[model samples]
Target chain A: MIELKNIKKSFDGLEVLKGISMTFEPGKTNLIIGQSGSGKTVLLKCMLGLYSVDSGSMLFGNRPLENMDDNQRRILRREIGMVFQGSALFDSMTVLENVMFPMQMLTDQDEKSIRAAAHEVIDRVNLNEATQKLPAELSGGMQKRVAIARAVVMRPKYLFCDEPNSGLDPKTAIVIDNLIREITKEYNITTVINSHDMNSVMEIGDTILFLKDGLKAWEGNKKQIFKTDNEAINNFVYSSRLMKKVKEVYQ
Target chain B: MKLLHHIGAYLLMLRLVFIKPTKAKVMRKLIFKDIQDLIVGSLGIVAFLSFFVGGVVAIQTALNIESPLIPKSLVGFATRQSVILEFAPTFMCIILAGKVGSFITSSIGTMRVTEQIDALEVMGINSVNYLVFPKLVAMMLLPLVINISMFLGILGGYTATLYGGFSSSADFIDGIQMDFKPFHVFYAFIKTVVFAIVLATIPAYQGYYMKGGALEVGKAATVAFVWTSIVIIVLNYMITQLLLA
Candidate 1:
């Protein structure tokens, strides 16, 4: 589990995360949803230690991340798995090599074992045929699969994905979402996803933290979202006519 | 003030790059690949430029020494001096600042814009050491290339002198043998080593710290080239003053 207490972050004096606090539970898909500039990405980055919080405590399990020394922080980082928004697979490596990279860098495992582990995760993502292909040779959706495979091959304790379904088609988006949710459950990993996609919110958001203007505008599950009385949450969630009509009928 | 900040940051980055590799086998593989990319890939152009420039230096030296007092052997002597002292080491590095430097900047800048560096950081890898240190190791073999350039350059001068009727083969050979100071070769090697470090690190600094997208990658390459050239020229003057002046 990861916990943030009164986390604040700013860039060039423009505060992005304003005293926000949240706890992400293990074995559940924790989703951060907000408008563009609502500090969703910033909050995710702060948790990933990509951005340092201005004044707050970030606890990974029981240990505060900021208090750890450099070496200790790096040791902790090896336990993390992140899927970048752009699917940042190493361009020089094929899919198999990309997936095997973390093991090669951090483990004393033999080559055969590493290859086996990579193959297992590649199969899990249903990308066995694409293992020999370079990232550029694959489609955007395929590349995201490769990224996810690479992130999970090490069996990380924490999984973070930033905009995993942004450019994907609807069907592919849900497939990726369900895949992540399944992985989170199978490994019992603490998973955090930053997304603005409503489909993802409804499909796999076991818990959703909604931010508006750097503040927590609302927080709830998918079912709770539709039934919430908060006007701001209602305005944002029912912005589409179809969603508004569904809400009208349901209410 | 900005310059001081860059210098400070560059020095700090160097400290990170010089750390022990997290995995020796991976580092060895990266170093060998860099040798192919940074050193071996540069051979053809280095040879081509060295030969042609050596020939031009010989021809120009022959044409200018019309004074009856100056010996024909002076053409070969002048060519040897220019090639060994300035052409092979300093000029070749300036060329590399354009060739290898641009490549380093663009590749690394592309990685930065694409979030590959972030990926490395997220994985607990020191991205600078992972990316830049192998290039530094590969470029340490730069003296091998410079030595080849020296041999080809003098040979090119010999050919030009003999064939262009600039001087007799015997006169040119005598000029080559006259006043041979081994220290000059050592001096050139020293300069090549220093320039190699500069070539590896400066462009890396530009790329690693770069911001923005594809267009900015191109811009960073240009900026890296300009800064590398400026540093090389400055070092050329300073080293010459300290060593030979």
Candidate 2:
């Protein structure tokens, strides 16, 4: 499990994460949702250790991430898997090579075992036919799958996805969402996703942290989120056409 | 102040580049790839420029010695002097700053633009060592290319002087042997090694620290070339003063 206690982050004296606190349990998809400039990405980056928080503590399973030495941080980083908003696969490497990169860099596994491990995840992501294809040759959805395979090939304790469904079509987006949820449950990984896609929030958002203007405005699951009357989250939820129709039916 | 900041940052980057070294297994692969990209890929152009420019120097030197008071062998000696002392080491590197410098800058800058560097970092890899050190190691072999340039340059000088009727083969060969200080060749090579470092690092610094998107990558390449050439020319002057003057 990952826990944040009063997490605050600022850039150039402008505070982005305003002492936000939340618990992300293992074996579930924890979605952080907010509109543009609402600090969801900032919060995610801080948890990822990409940004240093001003005066708050982030506990990754009782180990405070803010105070770790370089060696400790590196060890922790290896246990954390990130799927970037752009999918960020090395364009030069083929699908198999990209999947096998982390293991080759960090593990003592032999080549035969590493190849088998990479193929296992490649199969998990259903990218078996594109093993030799570079990232440029893959479609957007396929690229995301490659990124996912690379991220989870090591069987990380934590998984972070930044807008995993941004450019994918609706059907492909749902597939990616379900894939992440299934992987999270199977591995018992603490999965934190930063997204604005309502479909993702409703489909696989086992837990949701709603941030508004740098503050945690509400906390709940997809089932409970619609029933809440928090004005900020209501604005967010009803801003969607589908949610607007749902609100009309409720009225 | 901004210049001082860049210099400080550049030095810091150099410091970071050698620390927490990437695994030797990975580094060996990276080094070979860089060699393929940086050294083997560059042989043809370096050879072409050296040959043609060496011929030009000989023809120009021959034309200028029009008076009967001068021996025909002086044509060969002057060609040797120009090619060895300046054209092959300094001028050729300046040209390479355009070819190779831009290449290093654009490729790294594109990686930055695409967030590949961040991917390396998130994997607990030292992105600097992973990216720049391989290029640095590959450029250590740069002197080999410079040696070839020097040889092909003199060969071009020999061909031009002999075939252009400016000097006899014997006179030209004799002139090449005239007062040949091994130090001059040593000096040229010393300059090549130093210039090689400048060629590899300055462009890399520009690319690694560059911000903005695809357009900024092209701009950074231009900026890296300009700064690399300027440093190379300045270093050439300083080295010449110390060694030859």
Candidate 3:
């Protein structure tokens, strides 16, 4: 499990995450949903340790992330997996190489075992046919799959996905979302995903945290989300007429 | 003040680059790749420029020595002097600042633009050590290329002087051997090594710190080249002053 206590972050004196306190349980998809410029990405980055929190504490399991020394932090980072919004696969490497990169960097595993491990993840993502191909050769959805394979190949304790469905079509987006949820359950990993896709929030958002203008607007599961009457989240969730109609039927 | 800040940052980057790599195997692969890209890839152009410029120097020197009192051997001597003292080292590096410098910047800048650098960082890799250290290793082999340039340059000078009938082969050979101070070759090589460091690191600094997309990458390459050339020229003066003054 991962926990954040009074997490606050700012850039150039402009506060972005305002005292967010939350618990992300293991074996579930924890989705942080917010509109653009609503601090979702900033909060995700802080939790990823890409940005130092001005005032806060992040606990990965029982260990406080902010208190770990450099070597300790690095060791912990190895146990963490990140799927960037852009998919950030090394364009220079083949699919297999990209998947195997973290293991090669962080472990002394022999090449034979590493290759086998990489193939296992690639097959998991249904990307076995594209093992030798570079990222440029893959479609957007395929690239996201490759990114997912690379991230989880290490069997990390924590998984972070930043807008995994951004450029994907609706059907492909659902495939990626379900894939993440399935992996989270299978590994019992503490997964945190930052997304604005309402479909993702409704489909696989086991737990959702809604943010508005740097503050938590609402917190609940997808089933609970449709019943909530919080103004900010209601406005955000039902901003579209179709979603409003869906809410009307549910209500 | 901005200049001072850049210098300090550049020095700090160097310090970071010397840190122990997380994986020696990965570092070994990167070093070999950089060798192929930065050194081996540059051989053909450096050779071409070295030879043609050497021929041009011989011809120019021969034409200007109209006074019969000045022996024709001066053509060979001047060619050797010009090639070794300035053209092969300084001019060739300036050319590389365009070819190799721009390459380092654009590639790294694109990685930055694409978040590949961030990927490395998130993986707990020291991105500087992973990226710049390989280039530094590859460029340390630069003196090998410069030695080849020096040889081809003299051969070009010999060809131009003998064919143009400006000097006999024997006289030209004798002139080249006239005041051959090994120190001058040593001095040129010292300058070459120093310039190689500038070539590898300045462009890297530009690329690593750059912010923006493809268009900004292009701009950073231009800026890296300009600063690298400036540093190379200034270092050339300083080295020459300290050692050869």
Candidate 4:
């Protein structure tokens, strides 16, 4: 599990995360949903240790992330996995090599063992046929699957995905969502996803933290999202007529 | 102030790149990859340019010293001095700043824009060490490229001198042997080693820290080339003054 207490971050005197506090439990798809400027990515980056939080405690389990020394932090990072919004696969490596990279870098495992471990994850993600192909050859959905495979190949304790389904088609997005959700449950990993996709919200958002103007606007599950009385989240989540109609029907 | 900050940042980044090094196994593989990319991959252009430029130096030296009062062997001596002292080490690298420096910047900048560097960082890899240090090691072999340029440059001058009939072969050979200071070769090697480090790091710094979207990758490459060239020229002057003045 990961916990953030009163986490604040700013750049050039412009605050992005405004003392927001939240907790993400294991074995659930924890979604941070907000408008473009509402600090979703910032909060995710802070927890990933990509950005240092200003005046807040980030606890990965009982240990505060900010307190860990550099070596310790690197050790902790090895236990964490992230899927970038762009899918961020090494352009030069084929799918199998990409999946095997973490193990190759961080472990004492022999080539065969690393290959086996990578093969297992690649098989789980159903990328067996595409193992020899480069990232550029894969479609967006396939790329997401590869990213997911790479992220989980090490059996990391925490999984973070930023806008994993942004450019994907609806069916592909839901498929990716369900894949992430399944991986989260299968490994009992603490999974956090940053997104504003409503279809994903309804499909796999086991818990949702909604931010507006750098504040926690609301927190709830997919059902509660439709039923929430918070006007800002409602306005943002149901901006489209179809969603508004869906919300009306739900209400 | 901004320049000072970037310089400080560059120094810090170089420190970070050497700290907490990658696994030797991984680093060895990375070094080989970099050799293939940055050094071996660059042979064709280096050879081609060195040959032609050496010929130019010889021809120009031969043409200008047409006076009967000037010794014919001076053409060969001039060609040897020019190729060894400046053309092979300084001028060729300036050309490579366009070829290799842009490649380093654009490739790394593309990685930055595409979030690949972030991916490495998140995976507990030191992105600088993972990306740049191997290139640094491979570029230590840059003197190898410069060596080839030196040999081919003198050879090209020989070919041109012979074909142009500007001087007797024996006279040119005498000029080649005239006042051959071994210290000059060492000086050129020193310059090559320094430029090699600059080539590996400066463009990497530009690419690693670039902001904005896809369009910015090209801009970063251009900026990297300009900065690398400026630094090389300035350092060349400094080193020449310190060593040969």
Who wins the DockQ comparison? 4
lDDT of 1 by residue, A83-183 (tens): 99999999999999999999999899999999999999999999999999999999988999999999999999999999999899999999999999999
**On a 0 to 100 scale, what is the lDDT of residue A192 in model 1?**
96
lDDT, candidate 2, A1-251, per-residue tens: 99999988888989888899999999999999999999988888888888889988999999999889999999999999999989999978999999999999999899999999999999999999999999999999999999999999999999999999999999999999999999999999999999999999999999999999999999999998878889999999899688899878977
Off by over 4 Å in 1: A248-251
Candidate 3 C-alpha lDDT tens digits along A36-146: 999999998888888999998999999998998998889888988999899998988999999999999989999999999999989999998999999999999999999
Name the runs in model 2 displaced over 4 angstroms. Answer: none
Per-residue accuracy of model 2 over B175-243 as CA lDDT, tens digit each: 888889998988998999899888888999999999999999999999999999999999999999999
TM-scores for candidates 1 onward, in order: 0.98, 0.98, 0.98, 0.98
Deviation in Å, model 4, residue B234 alpha carbon: 0.9
Query: After best superposition, candidate 4 residue B231: deviation in angstroms?
Result: 0.9
Question: Of models 3 and 4, which has the larger lDDT?
Answer: 4
Pairs of residues at least 3 apart in sequence or in different chains that clash in candidate 4: none
The Cα local distance difference test for each model comes to: 0.94, 0.92, 0.92, 0.93
Once fitted onto the true fold, the runs of candidate 3 whose alpha carbons sit more than 4 angstroms away are: none
CA lDDT, candidate 3, residue A89: 89
Ranked by DockQ, top first: 4, 1, 2, 3
Every candidate's DockQ is: 0.83, 0.77, 0.76, 0.87
Tens digits of lDDT, candidate 1, B1-245? 99999999999999999784658899999999999999999999999999989999999999999899999999889999999999999999999999999999999999999999999989988899999999999999999999999988988999998899989999999998899999999999999999999999999999999999999999999999999999999999999999999
Q: On residues A92-161, what C-alpha lDDT tens digit does candidate 4 reach at each position?
A: 9999999999999988899999999999999999989999999999999999999999999999999999
Tens digits of per-residue lDDT for model 4 on B205-237?
A: 999999998899999999999999999999999
Q: Could you tell me the TM-score of chain B in model 4?
A: 0.98
Measured by TM-score, how close is model 4 to the native structure?
A: 0.98
